[model samples]
Target: MVTVKMLKPYYIKTDNEHVRIVLAYQYFSIIIQEKVYQFIPIEANEIRINRRTQKVENIDAKFAFQHGKDVVYLTMAKLITLPDFLQQLHSIAGTYYIQDENELNGNSSIQHAVLIDELERMNILRLIDKALDERDEKSFYELVKLL
Candidate 1:
């Protein structure tokens, strides 16, 4: 039976589509048969997650483990067998996922505010143009002040 001793990403990188969990030496460890094995990044150094679905996209990434002189390279497919390990990984990554969501929401709100401001400005410009067309000096002055 395999058991996870420790699992932590060195850092998380986020883009528009994906979140990457970068791993470093000694950052992840597991135990099998009472012997602790530290994970070493080999073919795979990072796990990619889909930002929208929050699901791991790279399960085939490889990692090496060492216990004394014996080293075994395994994939996420193997590590994911341990329910505890999977749960912990999700818990850690979920924090970053939530942060990404908050950031996107904040950005959307800012964009919405900008859009609203632009729309209001356009309306004012339209009113100013109407005032000029009608030769309404008082309305034109008031609209210009708004600008």
Candidate 2:
């Protein structure tokens, strides 16, 4: 059974207010003021951002985040690569943290590790299904708006 732990949040300062970001395995949850947003990691064919315009263009996904309005946008503006992501994490926590799943879990057996990987993927799919099932009309429309 896979259990999700409540991990510590990385607080970052934005122009408007301080926001808390919690990164789970393949997902990240953003806490802005009293509201929280949960997002799945979107894979893009090529993720490009114009820093001057504060516009992000992901070829695979149709999501637009303007600079100042979204705290997630502000934080993500800096993470263009793996090294950048690690640097940001280290800067926020004042320590180095790696997101290497195999190293962290210490799964030595190949077959056992594959099973674990499959289980984790299944779990994410299940959670997405649950969220879709429980979503209201407005929430559903909001997701559609992203397209």
Candidate 3:
């Protein structure tokens, strides 16, 4: 019998269309009989998720293990059968799915606008100071009008 002893994602990558969860050594482990096996990525190492549904779309990953001197490959079919694997994956990737890109863009735009306003105000103050230093009353009054 095989049982999962530990499962932790190495990192998560998100784009507009999908979220990819990467796994690495020491982060994922399993037990078979009395022996513990560590997952080593072979062809693929990521679990692809659909951003809209927040559901696992595919696991394009293969792992191998060293048993004695023989290399044993773990296939997708066997991995999916592990108890609570899907549930645990959902728990880790849940927060990333909840984030809305539009909301983030709105907040970023607001910050940019505030920064631009402050810069413009600073430039006006500098121009006013330059007019006063040159003893140009007309220029000083014109710069002050910007306030």
Candidate 4:
């Protein structure tokens, strides 16, 4: 189930060549980006966090092609509206050839998982309370602007 802090005004961006997923993690939010049909494993080090003040140091991210098959993109900056973004993603998916039509049609779902306890500036914030947090200031500044 979507949690209290995450059930607020937040944004996402996905595109033909990229996909951006942002969720609140404890005192900070984690933004994950993956290129279409890529295998970019999420590295623990890649997640940016602030330790002293315990805040997210960076939010702006670039999704590079992790794998060599399909393409995905960031959801918020490109789509502008969530509904519109989803619609576009659907249309784009329809354009691809289905190797296993049934498999492609398999049911899936999306849920926002909270990594932190509360929301900051309407977005999930306050990660300092959690264990082993990292902060990247430049990234946080970028995320603040996007959120």
Candidate 5:
């Protein structure tokens, strides 16, 4: 499992008691257990939210990967996009690899997990909101440019 701290934030907002941040492409990696795995993130085509729980539904991304002695046919389920938090979890559903004569056939599976804090996400949004609310064009545009 890859912890959230393993990700470097592109932007961070902090108060005396709170922290929020945004993460971007530069924050992702496909390596697992010291071995490099190849992965490509296609796109996030859908975004959903649950109003009652204030929880955002999973964002779908097309991903593909090939690893030594194993190959994983990637799908949206294997990629997790956290839109609100500006984060993404690659191989969240786990990946499988099987070694066969064809090299593409395998029965082995791999799992990579990403974690993010809801409060930290909210803090990041609020920081943006504050910049807009104050009509701080400089700060607002700076933040927007990161997106």
Candidate 6:
């Protein structure tokens, strides 16, 4: 999954009222909105923003933020190179806070995480089945909308 705030390094992503991020892989992501729209390959980047147009380009900061609690990785923007990602983790491992303890599922954020994980997985399956079966994106999207 992906977060909109995390969208800045790529194209201009609005819809700020709600956002979510998940480490679908070590980097790449799928972003869904209001349980309806979905976008993929949200990468991390070092960027220069065009204030007037609200566009972003020049990705350079892609890396993983890791802790015992969770790990955060970026993909779509391609901000940081793989080497940079590893170096950052090495440097931050000592000074940065890494939550290496058990995950707590008490907070609403955690609950949302759980919900997204389950729903995204189901949605992915649906997307694959539809694509293979020649189902329409509209129907698949609507199914996810309800989900």
TM-scores of all candidate predictions against the true structure: 0.62, 0.20, 0.57, 0.20, 0.25, 0.21
| Candidate 1: segments with Cα more than 4 A from true spot | 98-147
In model 3, pairs of residues that clash are none
What is the Cα-based lDDT of residue 37 in candidate 5?
49
lDDT of 1 by residue, 24-72 (tens): 8889888878999987766788888876677778888888888988887
Query: lDDT per residue, candidate 2, 97-131, as tens digits?
Result: 22357754675576688998898777666655665
Which ranges of candidate 6 are over 4 A from the true structure? Answer: 4-47, 76-147
Q: Each model's number of backbone clashes?
A: 0, 0, 0, 34, 5, 17
- Residue 126 of model 4 has an lDDT of 43
CA RMSD, predictions in order: 10.8, 24.0, 9.2, 26.1, 23.6, 22.2
Best by TM-score: 1
Candidate 4 ranges with C-alpha deviation above 4 Å: 1-45, 65-68, 75-147
TM-score of 3: 0.57
Estimate, for each residue in 8-124, the C-alpha lDDT of model 5 and write its tens digit. Answer: 445544333223333344443354446554532344323233323323345354444335665443333443333322343222211221224443333222111112455555666
Candidate achieving higher TM-score, 5 or 6: 5
TM-score of 5: 0.25
Model 5, which residues run further than 4 Å from truth? Answer: 1-5, 8-23, 37-41, 45-56, 64-76, 79-147
In model 2, which residue pairs have backbone atoms overlapping below 3 Å? none
**lDDT tens readout by residue for model 6, 1-147:** 333322222322223221122233233222333222222324532333332233333344454543344455654254333444334323322232222345433566688999999988887776767865886767667666554
Candidate 4 minimal-lDDT segment of 10 residues:
1-10
- How far does residue 124 in candidate 1 sit from its true spot (Å)? 48
How high is the lDDT of residue 57 in model 5?
A: 48
